[model samples]
Target: MHDERLANLLGAMALAIHDVMLPAVVDSSGVGVSASAALVVLGAHPGLSVSELGRRLGLSQPAAARMVDSLQEQGLVTRRKGTGRVVHVGSTRRGREATRRLLAARSAQLVDVLGSLTARQKQQLEPLLGTLLTALYRQIGDAERVCRLCHRSCCVQDALCPVGQAERSLAGG
Candidate 1:
């Protein structure tokens, strides 16, 4: 049975967390949300083409190019010609540093919010969140886009990421 109250509470919680988190993420990187996400993505998977980056970020090719231009101007990223006409994007040292700071800020904000819960509640909440994330991945069908801003290493420290697990399951692997 669909619980309207549960749905409403979850929606409110998501918005509340975004409200507190986005600013810290943006401020840490001194960039917009999308740009910060791009940095994080590049930090994890460097040397991606702008098109690939756009696909992960759910952005248009032109928009991704423009963003790369902006990052290059800020000395946060560098672009190099690939095998053919493709241009690959990678973060500079400054960009990597920015990504670290952005991730740290994001973690701090979430930690603050999670601090409100008791230890037992947090332990209980973890699996529930993983279930939700897996459901979301199934619905979205794109793990990279779904986890564009995620700290990938942390999520898989002890177990496979739920989204990744969902993706593999869908692929019958």
Candidate 2:
């Protein structure tokens, strides 16, 4: 049987992290969670269609369109006409800057949270977190959604990302 105490601690820790992380990301980007995610996604993969963006963010078509409209109004993103009725969304310079700030804020808050951990503790925690992320990717089955707000460069700098590795493994690659 699973340990209830472990589950509870994990849940509490997840909530605590969210509480610390969300405000920093939102304040830096001046957008709500979904919009912030959109900007991050766009910053990474420019010119994704609205429908695709919505799918990545787990939003409905109409909702995604409205989000695109709002972002355009904020001068954070631009929509260009694609072939036929498709609309491709890309980040503006301002949007890219916002994305950078959002990532920086997220990194700062996370670093602060990890400040209490010893270097040895952090080293130990890295593999544990990677294992958890891999398991999470297996369950969630959507790497893009799982990493929507992630600064990909950081995760990929040292080695292959655990989630990506999970994805590749699942795909039989």
Candidate 3:
């Protein structure tokens, strides 16, 4: 019961932080949350087919197309030719600019948060994050931890994150 309560509180805290911080970083601009997520996926894997992009972003193909459609209409993304005559989705100049602004806004928010953390607190946080991540992985398992990664790219590169575990499994590490 204690473990469950702890996990639940952690989940709630994560969601609460996201609720507060995401709007500070990304603009809604009448575009839906799914659309914003699509931009992030496209930024990671530019030139992915709508189908492939859907697979990566875990959306249905048609849903991915609709997201692309909105982005295209806004002149934020475009399609280019690919091998085997497949077309791929990528960000347009405007799209990159918008993404840049979004990232800058996010960075600013993060800076504000960081300013509140003392040097000693941050230093101690490093080890504590590892323990928390290990517990998170143990509770959630690899599939939910990676594919449904709550913070997406932020967790992908960290050595203690699930992607690292997935990669280790792939490489026999």
Candidate 4:
């Protein structure tokens, strides 16, 4: 039976996720998610070129350039040019540290959120979550290689949200 309880649970789950994911989300100053995404790619690749970073983050050249400029100004990133418009951007020590802190905080938040779930609940939920997530992603992924291509908000929110903390409702493995 389609119950009100299910709807309330879903709404609560959505709100909780939005709260936990706030730190990791890098919304642009006057930009969109694309600029923030570029930072992740650049941070991981370190010395990737502007063009390469742009492609990796799925941003236009102008957008990537703007992101790089903002990052450089913020001191979270730096860039160097080799030759013929070959520019490389790498994360600053500050950026790497920030990433670490953010990840750790998020992990801690998740731990606190699920502190009460019994072992059985987790066991039941993991598999169901994994399967459902896989199916959802598959359905969405089949549409486009890049998420920004999809206007659907979940394209940005779902994966980043720490839904694992809600393992009790999950019907895990």
Per-residue lDDT over 108-149 for candidate 4, one digit per residue giving the tens place of the 0 to 100 score: 565666777888988787666656655554554422223322
Model 1 error, position 90 (Å): 0.5
**Candidate number with the higher lDDT (2 or 4):** 2
> How far is each candidate from the true structure, as Cα RMSD in Å?
1.2, 1.2, 4.3, 9.2
Regions more than 4 Å wrong, model 1: none
Count clashes in each candidate, considering only residues at least 3 apart in sequence or on different chains.
0, 0, 0, 7
Candidate 2's TM-score reads 0.97
Q: For model 1, how does the per-residue alpha-carbon lDDT over 87-137 read when each residue is reduced to its tens digit?
A: 999999999999999999998999999999999999999999999999999
Tens digit of per-residue lDDT, candidate 2, span 1-71: 47998999999999999999999999999999999999999998999999999999999999999999999
- Residue 107 of candidate 2: its Cα lDDT? 94
Question: Model 1 — which ten-residue stretch has the worst lDDT?
Answer: 146-155
Cα error, candidate 4, residue 146 (Å): 9.4
Candidate 4: residue 158 lDDT (0-100): 47
Residues 51-131, candidate 3: write the lDDT tens digits. 777666667888888888888999888988788857699987777666655655655665576677899998787667666
- Residue 51 lDDT in model 1? 95
Question: Residue 144 deviation, candidate 2, in Å?
Answer: 0.4
- Please report the candidate that would top lDDT against the real structure: 2
Alpha carbon lDDT at 89, candidate 1 = 97
